[model samples]
Target: MLVGEHMTSPVITVEPHATVSQARKLMQDHDIRHLPVIEHARLIGIVARSDLNWPSAAKVPPDAMPVAEVMSGNVIAVTPRTTIENAASLMLANKIGALPVVDEEEHVVGILTAADILSVFLEVMGVGSGARRIEIRLPDRPGALAPAVQCIGSLGVNIVSVVSAREQDGWRSLVLRLATDDLEPVLTALADLGVEVVSTGEGDD
Candidate 1:
C-alpha cells in the first residue's frame, strides 16, 4: 500500500523556538515518540524522545533548552505516493523509526513510522493475531485455484490471505494464512486434489 493510505495525517509538530518541555508535552499528550520541527511553515528538523534525554552532569535541563538545539536538522522524508516496503527500507537504512511525509514544496503533510508499517504489513499478511500460515505451489493455468479454494471452503476454513508469485516448473507459489491452528485437514484436502504442499508452519503473535 502507499504511504498516504496509512500515514498519520495532520501531524503534530513543534516549532523551532518551542521549548523542549513543550515538545515533550506534545509527545506525551499525543502518545508519539517523534516530533517534526517546523520553522516558518517549513520542516527544519525532527526530534525524538531519546534525543533530548540529559545526563545528571549536564548543566542545563533538557526541557528548558530550545527544541532546535537538540533536534536533528538533517531529516529524511518520503512522499505520500511512496510504497510501504520502500518506506520501511528507508527507515532501516537511516536507523530511524519514523519519517516525515513531505509534499513538493517540502511542507510536512503527514508522518510514517516503523510501527505503522509493521501494523499494516501484519494486517496484510493475516498474522497480526497469531494465525498459522502456509506456502504451496499450484499450477499456473486457469481453474488451478478454483478447486483448491473450493476444497478449503468445504472445511469452513477461512483463507485469511493469499499471495502468488511466479515459480519454476510453470507453477505459482501461494502463501496462505488461516485463522485455524490445525492445518492437517486443509493440507489433506489439497493433497486429495493432487496439490503440491511446499511448506506449512505456525506463526507467533
Candidate 2:
C-alpha cells in the first residue's frame, strides 16, 4: 500500500517560534509523540516527545526555549506517493518513530508512524479473522505452490490470504490463511501432494 492510504492527515504542527512548553502541551493534548515544525507553511524540522526530554532541555527553561532550538533540523520526510515498505525502511535506517509527509511544495500534509505500519502488518497477516494459518516450505521452482493451492481448493476450503517469501537454499515459504478452522483435511491433502508443512495454527480471533 502507499503512504497516502495509511498516513494520518490534517496533521497537528508547531511553528519554529513556539516555545518548548507549548509543544509539550500540544503533544499532551493530542496524545501524539511527534510534531512537524513548520515555517512559512513549509516543513523545516520535527520534534518528538523524546526530544523534549533531552538532557540539554533540562538546562533551559521550557517556557523560554523555542522549539527550533531543540527540534531536529535535519529532518527525514516522505511524499504521499511513497510506498509503505519504503517508508518503513527509512524509519528503520534512521531509528525514527515517525515521518513527516510533504507535498511537492514541501508543505506538511500528514504523518506516518510505526503504529500505522503495525496495523498494516496485522491486516496483511489476517489477524483476528478467525481463520486457520498454515505455513509450508516449498521448492523455489515455478509451479511448486500450485499443488498445495489446488489441493486446498479441491477440498472446498476457502483461502483467506496468502503470503510468500524466498528462503535460503533455494526454498520458498508460503503462508496461507484459510476460512475454515478444520485444518486436518487440508493438512492431509497437502501431505498427499508431498508438500512440506512447516506449521499450522489458529489465527488470532
Candidate 3:
C-alpha cells in the first residue's frame, strides 16, 4: 500500500511564530501529537508533544515561546507515492513517530504516523472485521501448504491473509484469514482436506 492512501491530508499546521501554548492547545483539541510548522506555504519544521514538555531546552514558558524554537528543523518527510513499507522503515531508522508528506516543491501535503500504520496491522490480522480466521498445522514438507490452500480456493472462499511460522513442537503452522462471515463451510472444507483447525473466533473478540 502507498502512503497517500493512508496519510492524513489537508495538513493541520502551526505557524513558525505560533506560541507553544497555541500548538499544545491545537494538538489537544484535535487529538494529534505532531504539528507541522509552515511558513509562507513552505514546510519549515515539526513540533511534537515532547518538544513542548522539554522546558530545559527552550527555557521559556509555553505561552511565551514560539513553536519554531522547539520544533525539529531537520524534518524527515516522505512523498505521497512512497509505499507504506518504505515510510515505516524510515520511521524505524529515525526512531520517530511521524513523517510529514511533502510535495516536490517542499509543500507539506499530509502526515503519516504510527497510528495510521497500526490500522494496517489490524487489517492484516483481520481483527474486528467479521472475517473467519483459521490455523492449520502442516507437515514439514514442500507440497503441504499448496494442497491446504487449494482446498479453500476450490470452495471459492477469498483468503484475506496468510502467514506461516514454525512452532516449538517442530511443526510449521499456517494461519489464514478468510473474507467470509460463516466459518462452518470453510472449516468443513479444511476438515475434508485433513487440515487441522487450531482456533476460531468471531468479530470483536
Candidate 4:
C-alpha cells in the first residue's frame, strides 16, 4: 500500500539543457508520456509529450527550443514512505497522472502513476468477466466470510472481488465488487440473511 511498492524506479530523465527534439526522441523510443527533467542530479521539472509537439508547418528550428523552455517546473512529487492512498490523492488534487518520487534532497528516485494504482486496486479487488465491485462493512468472526459469500451465491451473484479490512475493533468493512447487474436483490437477500449491507453500488457498465 506504500508508494515505494508500486512506484517505477530507475526512471528515465532528460537534462534541462537537452533539446526538445532530444526529449521527444527519448519519449518515442521508450514509448512513455512524461519525462522528469534533471540537472546536476537535482529534480528540476517535468516535460510531457504535449509540450514537445509543434506544428509541422512552423519554421522554428528544434535546437532553439530546450526542455527548460516548455517543461512544467511546478512538478508534484511524493516521498517513498507515502501511502498509495495519499499519493493517489495528490495526483487527483493536482490533476496529474504521474508523480515523481523524490528523496530528502529532491533527487528523483521513482515515479508513481495512475496506472500503477489501478493495477494494484484491480488485483486487490479481483478482476474478471462479470467482475462486480461492491463496498460493505461486516462483523469479524470465524465464519463471517463464508456465509456472506454464500448469501450472494444463493442469489446467483458471481463474486469477482471481495476485499475485507479490519478497522475500529470487531467490525470489519468490506468492499465487494461482483460481476452481476441485479445487485439490489442480492443486497436485500444479504440483509435478509442477517449480513449487514452497509452500502452497495454497480460496477463498470
Query: lDDT of each model, Cα atoms only?
Result: 0.89, 0.92, 0.86, 0.83
lDDT of each residue in 1-205, candidate 1, tens digit only: 9999999999999999888888988899999999999987789999999987877797778667899999999999999999999999999988999999999898999999999998897788787756678888888889888898888888998888887846778799988887787999998888889998887885343
How much is 189 displaced in model 2, in angstroms?
A: 0.9
Model 4 compared with the native: what TM-score?
0.68
lDDT by residue for model 2 (42-71), tens: 999999999887465377789988999999
Instruction: Tell me, by TM-score, which candidate is best.
Output: 2
Cα TM-score per model: 0.76, 0.91, 0.83, 0.68
Per-residue lDDT of candidate 4, residues 96-142 (tens digit): 88898899999999988889999878777776545656677777778
Could you tell me how far off, in angstroms, the CA of residue 113 lies in candidate 3 after the best superposition? 0.8
Model 3: how far residue 196 lies from native, Å: 4.2
Error of 2 at 143 (Å): 1.8
For model 4, give the 10-residue run with minimal summed lDDT. Answer: 196-205
Query: Candidate 1 or 2, higher lDDT?
Result: 2
For model 3, how does the per-residue alpha-carbon lDDT over 57-89 read when each residue is reduced to its tens digit? 655778988989889999999999999999989
How much does each candidate deviate from the true structure in C-alpha RMSD?
A: 4.2, 2.2, 3.1, 6.5
